[model samples]
Target: MRIVIALGGNAMLQRGQPLEAAIQRENIRKAAEVIARVAKDHEVILTHGNGPQVGLLALQNAAYDKVSPYPLDVLGAETAGMIGYMMEQELYNQMPGAQIATMVTQTLVDNNDPAFQDPTKFVGPVYGKEEAEALAAEKNWSIKADGEYFRRVVPSPLPKSIIEVEMVKKLSEMGALVICSGGGGVPVRKLEDGKLEGVEAVVDKDLTAALLAEQMGADALVIMTDVAAVCVNFGQPDQKKIHKASVQGIGELDFPAGSMGPKIDSCAQFVEKGGRFAAIGSLYDVEKIVTGEAGTWITNEVEGISFYEKKEEAAVA
Candidate 1:
């Protein structure tokens, strides 16, 4: 089967972990091990989150008074290149004979997207309430609470189209493990005269991943994040993990906007747009997740849902 795997930021850099090159490389190495296993059986295309990395670049540029900070589009490109290299190298180490390639693809977004007016996507390093407040006031920047810490917020517009999608398709068809669309393909917009220009926005990675999957005619779309499964009543004591759900069923429940919400929404969009099923789960559980052994699988089948607990009981019987 052909699979499009979207790696969440946690797959590369853990929350609260320093963004050191060594730390990121080690994490990618671990992730590559799992991905290599999947590549052995399935044709794969990879994409990943770049919130932490882009934010770090923005912060670093902000500190250097010698030059103006580059726009988010450029930073997105930089992170794509940076992260893609590490992922490609690590994947090569894990699967020596496999052909792995990375591309800094481009995704177009509407210049007039409402996201520009409402910059809700969080980025950069997390800061304490007090520090975040101070920074927001001093820098005149939009800020938002991310878990216990606060970070800068940016517009996360929906991806309209992937510019280099054909190339990606060509590479994957030839059985190459291709990694592209880092930071959602460096957000761009088309001008009136047919020229393309970069935008100051972030394109949600999961949404772009769905677009990639649809374009590639993939059999499965797996979103690998830090969480083991998608849970309902997430923080409550009675919270339950959803093993399998119809796309429509998953849509009926509400999830936090900042975290898992976009992932579920993107997955639903994929199945609705003619892709097979989509799975949301941990990177560590990737092989099982894509195979329907783990994660919250969202499908378009008539049967509503199948709970993992029940499946396990049936096996025991």
Candidate 2:
């Protein structure tokens, strides 16, 4: 089976964990173990988010003051290479004989995309409103409210095409595990004359992954994030975890736009476009996810939305 696995950046670098090199590598190492197992029996194409990494790089770049902070496109490419190298090394260690490659991909977007007018994608560290506003003034950054805190936000355009998608498919057809399109492939826009230039915006990785899967004719799109499953009434007493849903079933639901929304939309788009299935679950559960033993699976095979039984809370000590 052919699968495209989208790794959530926050999942790879666990929330609240320090953005240290060794820590990130260890996390990727753990992820590689599961991916290696999946790659053993089936073809795998990998894409990962660079949210945390890119934000950290931007912070570091801003501090240097030697040159203006590098644009988001450049930082996105750096994160792709940085994260891909770690994943490549770890995967190679697990499977010395397997073919693996990482490409610096580009996702083409339109300059006129409405997303530019609305910067909703969050990046960088959260700060108090006062501090955030000050930084925004200093850096010419757009700041937005994220929960009680504020953070940098950027344009996140819809993906029109992946510039190197054919090569990605060709490499995968040749039996290679290809990792590409980190941070939505360094968001680029093509000029009227057909030249491409990096745009100063981020592209949603989940949407880009769906586009990639569609173009590659993948059998399944598996989005591996930190969450165990997609939930409705999340964090409320009546919370329910979706285990299975038909394409239309999942489409009717609501999820947080910055987080699960893109994931849900991506899965629905893939299945609706005739992919066999699309799944969402923890990165650690790939083994179970493939067999439909775990995770939220979206397909037309199911009649309506079905949810996993509520897990009982642990007894208090």
Candidate 3:
């Protein structure tokens, strides 16, 4: 089956880990092993998040007084190239002789998207509220709460189309495990002359992945995150894992704007648009997720929503 897997940023950098090359590659090496296993039996198109990577570049650029900091579009492209290179190399190492291609894709967004007025996407490393505020003040950045900590935020416009859709699709048809649309494909908008210009915002990768998957006519759209399943009342004592859900049923729940919200919304959109499967779960267990052994599966095949029993609850029963 053709599958589009959107790898969350945390899969590589993880929370609280230093953004070092060795560390990122090591994490990717492990990820490649998992992906290699799945690729052996299916056609896979990969997309990845760049929340931490781009933020680190922005920070580094700010530190250098040589010139003005690079634009988010440029930073996003650099991250796509850098991260794509790493991922491709690792995948090649894991699956010798396997075909793989990574492209610096461009995603089209509205020049006047309301998201420009509302900076909601979180980027950069997490920091305490005080530290985030200090950085925001010094850097003239927008800051917002990311769970308990805070981080920089920028406009996250919705993707309207992919500029390189035909090429990406062609590559996939040729049996390559293609990686494109990193950090939402370097957000851009069309000019009056039909030319495209880069935008200052970041497009959410999950949304782009969904759009890509739909356009590619893939059978499944899988969002691989750090969590085992989508949870309701997250981080609370009564939190429950969603084991299965219908597109409409799962779309009604709430999730954090910067984190799980896009994942849930993207998956729902895919399944609602006639996709056979949409899932959310840990990247390490992607094989199980695709096979229905684990994670929260969202589809029209289910009647409604169902929750996984807590270990204690199941044991007692």
Judging by lDDT against the true structure, name the best candidate.
3
- Model 1 spans with C-alpha error above 4 angstroms: 310-317
* Model 2: lDDT of residue 200: 90
Cα error of candidate 1 at position 9, Å: 0.3
lDDT of 1 by residue, 265-316 (tens): 9999999999889999888888878778788899986357665575542331
lDDT scores of the candidates, listed in order:
0.90, 0.88, 0.91
TM-score of each: 0.96, 0.94, 0.96
Residue range 93-130, candidate 2, lDDT tens digits? 99998889999999999999999999988876677889
Instruction: Give the per-residue lDDT of model 3 (tens digit) for 1-317.
Output: 99999999877899989989899999999999999999999999999999999999998988899898889999999999999999999999999998899999999999889999999998999999899989898888999988788989999999999999899999998888999999989999999999999999999999999999998999999999888888889878898888889987887787877678888899988888879989999888799889987788999999779988777223212
User: Over the full model, what C-alpha lDDT does candidate 1 score relative to the true structure?
Assistant: 0.90
RMSD to the native, candidate 2?
A: 2.5
Candidates 1 and 3 compared: the better one by lDDT is 3
